[model samples]
Target: AYEYTLKAEKVCEEGTQKQIPLYDHYFFSILICAEVFKLDSSFHDQAKKIAYKNLKNLKKVQTQMPKNFRSRYLLAKAVIKMNFSPNLKKEISFDFLSVIGVANEDNYLHIEGIACEIYGRFLKDKGIHLDGAHYLKRALGLYERWGANFKVQAIANEISNIQNDDFNKEININSFIEISESLSNERDLEVIFKNILETAITFSNSLKGAIFRRDHNQYFVISNVNNDISHYPQSIIDYAYNSNQIVRIDSIFDLEDFSKDKYFTNNQVRSLLALPLVANGEVESVLYLENSKVDKVFTADKTRILEIISTQMALSIKNAYLFKNLEKLVSERTEELEKKTHQLQISSGEKQTLIRVLCHDLANLLMSSRISFKRLNKKLKELELSDPDITRYLKKIDSSFTNQSHVIDNVRHLELAKEKGFQITLTTVDFLKTLTNSIDTFEQQISTKKINIVINENLNDIEVLSDELCLGVNILNNLISNAIKFTFEGGKISFGLQDDDQEYYYIYIKDSGIGMKDQMVRNMFQDNIHTSTRGTNSEPGSGFGLSIIKSYVNKMNGDISVTSKHKDDFPEESGTTFILKLKKAV
Candidate 1:
C-alpha cells in the first residue's frame, strides 16, 4: 500500500491536478508504514524516523486541513512516538491526552475511540492495569456505537483477561472517573484544591486531610478537611516539599524520636501520609492525610490513587491561578480606558470655554482702541494743512486696528454660535442687497489685492428667508473674504444665486486664485480642523472663516459645498467656487 501510494503521489504532483488530495494520501501512507514498522524490533528505528517525519509534515499542513483530519493526524503521531520511544513516555502521554481533549471537543467519535484504545493498551503494557481497563471499556462502548463488532469483542476479551488475572485486588474505576469529572469542572483554585483534599480523604478512608500549595519560597495550607485538630506542624510540610518525596508514617509509636516532632505531640495523628505533587522537576503542592483512630489506615492501593489525584490537582491549580490573574489585568485596563476618556472630554470643554472668554475680552479691547484711533484721525483731518506723512501713518494704524477688530469679532461670533447653538430669527429680505452689503464691507481688502468682484445679473432682486442683517452678512462676508484673499492680483471673483423648484436658493462664489487641495477641501468646514493657507500676496488669515460660514449656513437651514483646483497647476481653469444654499422666501 505504501509503494502504491508513492506512485500515486508522483502522478498527482506531475499531472495537471490538485496536490491537496495527493498530500493527504502521502500523509496516510506514512502513518500506515510507521504502524507496520512498530511490530518488528529490526524496524523500530525506521518507525521512529517515519513518525518524526510524519509529525513535521502534519504540523506544516495542520492549519490548512479540516479539524477532524488534523486531530487524527496528531493522535497517530503521538501514538507512534509513544510506541517507538521509551524515554519520551511522559511527554507523549501529555500530547496523547491533549489530542483526546480535541477529539472530544470536535465530536470526532472514531478518533476519540482510536486515542482511547491506544492509550489503554499503552497503560496496560506499563503495569497500570486498572486505568488501562477503564479507558479500554470507554473505547469499547464508542466502538459499539459504530457497529465495530470485531473491535468490541477484542476489547471485551482483553477486559475479561485482566479481570480474571487480578480479581483478588480489584480497582475502583467509578471512583477514579468521578474524581476526574469533578476536577475538570472546577475552575477556582481554592475550590479545586479543597475538592482534591476531600476526594483524597474519601478514597483513602482517612480521618482528616489538608492540601499545602507552594508560592515562590513559601508553602501555605490552602485547603483542609475535618479541621478539628490543631496545627499539623510546618516542619512536616517543609520536609515533603524540600525532599520531593512522600512521607508515610504508618506507626508513629515505632519511632523512638517520634516525641521530638511537634505534630505528633500537638495532634492525635497516629498514621500520616504526605504526598508531594511534583511537575516539571519542581514540587508544586503536597497532600497531607491523617488518621487519628487507626494506625495503618492508608494502604499501597490508596496511596497510588492519591498520587494520581495529586498530579492532576497540581496542573489545575496552576491554570486557575493564571486565569484569575488574566481577569484582574483585563479589569484594570478597562478602568484605565474609561478614566482617559473622561479626562479628554473635560479637557475639550475647558478649551472651548477659554476660547469664548479670550475672544470676548479681546473684542472689547479692540473696540476701545478703534474708538481712540477714530478720534485721532478726525483731529488730524481737522488740520488739513498738517503733514501728509502723519495723516498717512494714522490711516495705516487705523486700518490695522480695523482688521484686528474684524478678526476678534469673527472669533466671538463663532464662540457664540457654538455655545448658544445656531438659533436664527428668520425674516424675509432681499438676497442681492444683503450680498452687496457683505461685499461692500470687504472693499478695502479687495482694492488692496486688486481683485475684480462680479455679481451675476440673474441674482438681482432675489429674496430669501434668513437673518439677513447678521447671519446672512456673516456667511457672505466669510466666503467673499476667503475668495479675495486667495485670488491673485487682477483676478475675477463672480457671485450668483439660483433657486430650485423646492423653494431653496443656491449662492455660488467662484474665485480665480490658488485652488485648495483635496484634503483642504475635505476639512474646510470642520470646526475642529484649522485649514489656514497664505494668500497670493502672502496675506494672513484666521482659518476660522469656513467654520463660521458652515455654522451660519446650517442655522439658516442651508448647505454649502466648494470645488477648486490650484491656479499654478491649471493656469486657465485653476480657481475655487463656494456654493451656499438657503430656503427661498414664500
Candidate 2:
C-alpha cells in the first residue's frame, strides 16, 4: 500500500493539476497512518497538526472530490488511524461503510480493502478476538500484494499491539493448570459465565454488566451485578436475535432511530452491546453487557477482553451439554442391560431343571433296554433249533440291538461337543461340490418324504476356509433336513454364496417352508427350543440342529439371519429367507 501511496507523493511533489483530487486524499490518508503503523507517538504532536491541516484541505475540495475515484481506500485508511484514537474516535463515529460510500461507484478495491479493515477492527474492538488477528494478518498480505503499503503497515501495527496484549494477559503454565482445576467446581454454565464476566468487568474497571439468554418461549436474564432486567420486553430480545451479531450502541442519540420500538425506548439505557453466544457449532443464547452511565461506547480493549472470555464461555457450555447427554445415555443403557441380565439368569435355572429330567428318563430307559436284550438272547440260545421260528426270533433281537447303538452314537456326538472346545480344523475346499454332497447324503430321508431337493444355480466358483470334513457336512445336514422336514414335497430349497471386496462370502440357504413368527425368530437360538409345527408328513425333529449351527458359526466368525413371510399376509411371496455370511478363502 505504501508503494501506491509513494506514487501519490510523487504526484504531489510535481504539483500535477490533473491528479490533485486523488493525490491529495491519498497523501493525507497516508500521512495520518505514517505514525500509528510507522510514525511513533513521539511525533504525535507534529502528526496531529499535519492531520488537522489535511482535514481542512480535504473539506475545501469535498464538493469537487472525484466521484469516479475509489473513496473507500481513503476511508479505510482513515478508520485505521482513528480506530484506537482517543480524540479522532470521538470526532468521527462513522465506520468503514460510512467512509467507503462517500466514493461514487466503480471503485471496488478501495471498498473491499476498507471492508476487511472494519470487520477486523470491529472484532478487536468488541472482544471477539478469535480469528481477528489472523484475519488482519491475511488482509495485510493482500494489501501488500496490491502494493498498498500504507494499509499493510497499519494492519501489522495492530497485530503487534494485540500480540503484546496477549502476552501480558497470558497466565503462567502452572497457574493456568491450577485455575483449570478450580473451574471443575464451577459446573453450572450460567454461573460460570456470570462469575467470569463479573470478574472481567471488575478487573477492566468497568461499571455494572448484565448477560441474557434466549430460551424457547422465554428470555432468561441469567447474569447481572445489582438487580434483574427479566421484566424487559421481548422487542429488545427480538432485535438482538434478528441481527444475529454483535451490536454496540454507545449513545442514546445513535439509537433514537429505534425510539418507535417498545424495548429500547423504555430501557433508559445509555451504552449497550449484544453478542451472540456460540457453542458446539450451535447458537444456544445471546450475551450482552450494558453500562447506564460514564462511557458512551465499548472500547477496543473491552472488546478484546470479552473475546477471550467468550471462548471459555463456549467451552463451559459445550462441556455441560456433553456431560448431561452422557449421563442420560449411560443411565438408559445400564437399565436395559440389567433387565437382560436378569432374564438370562432365570433362563439358566430353567435349563438346569430340564437337563435333570432328561438325564433321569434316559437312565431308566437304558437299564430296561439292557435287561430285555439279555433275556431275548438267552431265549434264542435255549431254542437251539435251525427252524424258521428260531431265525425270526434272532432277527428281532439283532434289529433291537442295532437301534439301541444308533441312539447311543447320536447322544455321544452331541455330548462330546458339549465337553470339548469346538475345534475347527479349516482347509481349502470346493464350496459348491461339498454342499451338493451333503444334500445327497440326506436323500434317503428326503425321498421318504418325497421332497424335491434343488441345487438351483451355482453362483460362482467360491472357495471358503472351513472344516470341510466336519462343518460343511454338519451345517448343510441340519439346514437341508430342516427344509425337507418342514416344506411340502415340491417346496424349493436354494443355496448360494457371493464374493466381494472384503475377501469374504455370503452363504445363503433359503427354503419355501413354514415361516416363523416374530417370537419364534428370537427364540430360535435357544437350546432344545423349536417353535414351528410338524411337517406335511408329520415328521419329528430334535430342534438341536439350529443351536449347534449358531455355535459353529460363532467359532468361524460368520453371521446368519432369516427373513420369512406368510401367504396369508402376502399371497405371492411366501418363502423364508436365510442368509449366512462367511469369509472367503485366500
Best-fitting candidate, scored by TM-score = 1
Give lDDT for model 1. 0.68
Poorest stretch of ten by lDDT in candidate 1: 166-175
Query: Model 1, range 16-74, lDDT digits (tens) per residue?
Result: 35456755654566666666676667766655675566566666666676573677677
If candidate 1 were superposed on the true structure by all CA atoms, what would the RMSD be? 29.4
Instruction: Give each prediction's root-mean-square deviation over alpha carbons.
Output: 29.4, 31.6
lDDT of 2 by residue, 1-586 (tens): 4345446655674775546665455544544454444447675554455455555455545446545433633553465456336355534435544553554244445455555565566656656453345446546655776789888778766765664454334322222222222243343656665665555444332334655665676566766554355444345556666666666667777675466666665667666666665554465556666655434435565665555445445444544444455445545644554455456643544444543444445445545444544553464356353456545544644554454444444344554455565566777777788787677656556776666655546555777777775555456666777777767677777777533458667777777776666776777767645443566577655455677676666666676677777556655666676666766787
Question: Highest lDDT among the candidates is held by which one?
Answer: 1
Estimated TM-score for each candidate: 0.36, 0.31
Residue 117, candidate 2: how far off, in angstroms?
A: 99
Model 2 regions lying over 4 Å from their true place: 1-422, 456-460, 528-532
Q: How does each model score on lDDT? A: 0.68, 0.56
